[model samples]
Target: MGEKGECSGVKPSDDEIWAKLVPSDSRYSDVEIRSDEKVICSEISAAFGDKHSWCKIIRNSDLCSATVENKSPNTILVDGTEVHNENTVVIKDGSEIIPGPDKGGFVSYRFDILSSPETSQRQLQICVDVENAKCSICLNIWHDVVTVAPCLHNFCNGCFSEWLRRSQEKRSSVLCPQCRGVVQFVGKNHFLRTIAEDMLKADSSLRRSDEEVALLDTYSSVRSNLVIGSGKKNCRKRAHTPVDDQSDGTYLQCPQCVHEVGGFHCNNNTVHLQCQACGGMMPSRLGFNIPQYCSGCDRSFCGAYWHALGVTGSGPYPICSQDTLKPISEHSISRIPLLAHENNVHEQNITDSCIRQMGKTLQDVVSEWIVKLNNKEIDVTRLALNHVETINARTSVCCDCYQKLVSFLLYWFRISIPKYRLPPEASAREDCWYGYACRTQHHSEEHARKRNHVCRPTRGSNM
Candidate 1:
């Protein structure tokens, strides 16, 4: 008997006796095991045929643990293992117990420790690599991590928002700064933001200067998930025709002036949405299933709606081509996008050289990867695009987004190459310490040529 219990030599404090047995059979009540005495399996003896002592629970030195000795003449089982008569087995919280050998007619009970031990109050430790918490764009701990769809890459909210603004201004489509995937959606990731914040709190040195943070905050416009638009321009050539007299010089002629389209005719009373692609106007029909607005960006485009109505570009009415906004499957890529590999020209040249060495065109490699992407063979965890799971060959995307997708696929193409398969000169080079995030590759031609940038960063900082 324990010091506190008559059955064991070890003794637990008065308050430490919290172990008990919870019977599986509702007819039997719970059996409390005290440190001062051992618990005999008498409460559930009716199910076991007799009230004979089948088992005895003796308290151990640890308040949360106890030892169960089989007292029944027949064998019993504790947590699936056989415990013969006189054999004692250690029991902890949630340990299952059954009497009379295999579970045929005997009721089972769970040994539960009602109170947690003092050691359980200690703080927990978790391992998280700081490198993963840094933003690829700013090369620092994320200020407010934002995750982009399709690619699902993370970045600082201010950094990505600024990138989004610049990409939108420079082109109709917004490309991810990290993977160059056309960003269909972007929003602040509360989970990653917490991790980033925790990392910064752990190491203050990773934090950016107050001034830099303030500036970045000012540039952040993304408060929630934003759907980006492909800035497709209307490229259809207008035919020579007379302008409508009712049309003020400010508005282009509506298609309804010629004839009814899709069983609906436009009138002066009908509200109209101006086309962002071409300077044209189309009647806004909210009830119609026809898509007058680009899904990528909520902006209105007369191309799909007009095309659905069998209307073509004329002198009086300007309609965009179907190519302006279509499904991602219809989009094609011929050349390498300049935005590939974080816009590193050296890496781009190396990739181009490698492609030529393999006797493959950029288009061939892109098409092959697209097949892999559609087959779900590729891991898109690192790809920085919105609605990544929804992206496939048939997914609707703008021409710019398609280019961005091609660029992202090309990256996987370059990185997946075996060293021996690379050009001899390229194969001889080693990987940069900072990998794709290497800043030196942008400025130092010798360094860029000597080291590869397609790999992940070995160190969190250039230092």
Candidate 2:
């Protein structure tokens, strides 16, 4: 939070300071951090452009607090404590930080954690729509989802493969079952296959028997992407052209496949990631510094594409902002997101009160635990999150990922403290049966606040 602990930088704007600070909130657990920001300072100053005198927010990582760094030799009071030059006082939520001796300068701002509206609304479980998943040929749920290009029709892999084989025997061009466009390309849609499996699980009646599945698997031919029969035996063989030439092939191709863009051309084997934000296509760069995929939603984005291409969003073709994607370590946040602690706003409130009573702020508490986490002083076995094994302070994660990490670490901090040391309200609470998995934690804020979710099962409690 400091130049390894010094404080001598220009004061920043409120928005700028908020961007660097990361207060804990559970909602950010699944959301991306604001991508458009660029600044990464850890402190805030009350007096900007002042050479001789001012107040500053000092990040004391060793002490686990954001201290008020009094640069002015005069007496500076932080929450009524007289602070001298270069010395610091711990900052708390709503603690008044006054610059100049005895508040004479009139520069004052209160340290506070900003909270956002809760986002726990989820759709109720409902019946699966098997009809949408059914293939036109088989009239059953798709065995393996395959999307045909040009017409963009989707069908079972087995159904398409069989139709393809029959069409080839007659030397006739293949046609889309639904749109009748000459099929120019086809690919196994992995994302859709996952959705199809979920549908079968939701309604077992939609599932085909194992024997049927095995037969379908044998007949399926679509692997990654297949360039289907070109021109028309479906319509006359045209002149030889690049795969992207619509005149050479009846079906259309993705934007990247058809033209030279950013000094690159897509050949037969280029794996592509379609941007979820702008359906543009960019070659997938696995293990590359260019961030093509968002760590939060596991979706591809084109922000890095524009950046790498040395182009702007104002380019003729659609170009996403570079802020859309970046390494997680590159993001600098200063406030705890409001949705931390599994969206249980109440638990965060209790933890905030407990920290204040102990003469510390939320930032101070999180800093202490983060140091423990980095030193391997805390156990990570029971952390509730995906990819738990790979999570660490140094891991590059989206904003949501960072919040989830903070929430998990905070849980450990609360539980590790002795019962007597906990705030009076939290000290007397009983642990819930569901722990972090309780459904009520999502819907009822009161219930989540009343019950302690950090405790282990008692000898006679419900399992």
Candidate 3:
């Protein structure tokens, strides 16, 4: 007989064991079941000491009950029932097991479960209405769901993307399809996308055909979170001046409206784009050589266009400074961006601390990594930007997009560093099971500080 192990104050995670075997006698040590399948023998070791292969204990998928299988010819009785060789019997909490057919001169153990599977597993369940997950535009379960800000309305990326294209062509302002509120931002809602997928899986009848999904994918243009505009109408507003015979208050005007610039003038049919920064208007130059829209976010900015035409901010026709939008090579960062590490302040602090410990400035580190990005040495698959493949040092992006780029680059920089090269405190911490995909890191400070989130997730779909 073996001695029973006392229960410890700390509990194991779901992946670990929640039960143990307490021996009736004090001679043998209690066996702690750590894995899904464990074998018990005379060796009395906690981890796989079953050299004789007496019997095997298999944890059921439910994580509460377990089954005991007789491996050896020895008589094994599970709760007074004989478990023949190659046979098994179900065992629950407080179930007694005797190695011999009888209790005499045989070791008997009690299976004690410390915690239930439901209690050990750390999971947050959100009950979402299935109908609410459907896209308003397509009237189906959202395929590639995207969320628009201000109204917080959601739609299929393809449906909204096509809608956005048509809206930009006709009007300067893009409104939510479901709500009339002005759209200030739009982004792929990964969380909602998962929910939509789960819903489709639950009911296959709700799923669209393969051909329809392919067609919708072709129209989908949104790749990352987009800053739509400054929430102001992009339409050109008539200057508040004395109404002349040539002027009509009904029609809006841009810089090209009054006089021709760049050998071109805005006609009544000319499409316009509102600047996300200054709310100024510019003719939508689709095939023209001038860069009017940011390649990173697809948002229009008047800085580069106005600078190319040598226009400056004036009165009602305000223009942004050239610094507002520029090539990636021209952008610089003095400190770490808030959007870095998925806005996990703890991870950001760790990265900032690591950079300082390395005796390098944020700008210096960013410049070095940017070179790698331009040289095509770094993978941009994780970069949340539109036209990501076409982006390089020469690509024009807004200040917000520039920050996103810097954050992406910083991620690579942090991950590239060897563990030994990290600060002593940071290097000592263990990697988080969920890595950067960890939702707990955002809410739990102690968990965030104790685990490294820069690495890849060891488990879950994010892996």
Score residue 418 of candidate 2 by CA lDDT.
87
Candidate 2: tens digits of C-alpha lDDT, residues 198-244: 78877897788899988987887554455553433222366534333
| Model 1 CA RMSD to the hidden true structure, in angstroms | 25.7
Better candidate number, 2 or 3, judged by lDDT: 3
Pairing residues by index, what is the TM-score of model 1?
0.44
Residue-wise C-alpha lDDT for candidate 3, range 1-463, written one tens digit per residue: 3312332322434564456775666354557776677766564344654445567787787666889988768778899899888899999877888876678766688786545335444334567787888888879999988898768899999999898888767775677889777776677788888888977887899999999999999998665455443223334366544212123222245688667888988664444666778776776765677778788877778888888887777645768888878998898888899989877887788789889988999988988988888789999989999888888888989899999999999899999889988878789887865688766556545556767988888755566
Sorted on lDDT, highest at the top, how do the candidates line up? Answer: 3, 1, 2
Candidate 1 per-residue C-alpha lDDT over 70-90 given as tens digits, one digit per residue, 9 for 90 to 100: 987878899999999899899
| TM-score against native, each model | 0.44, 0.43, 0.54
RMSD in angstroms, all models?
Answer: 25.7, 19.9, 12.7
Local distance difference test scores for all models: 0.68, 0.58, 0.74
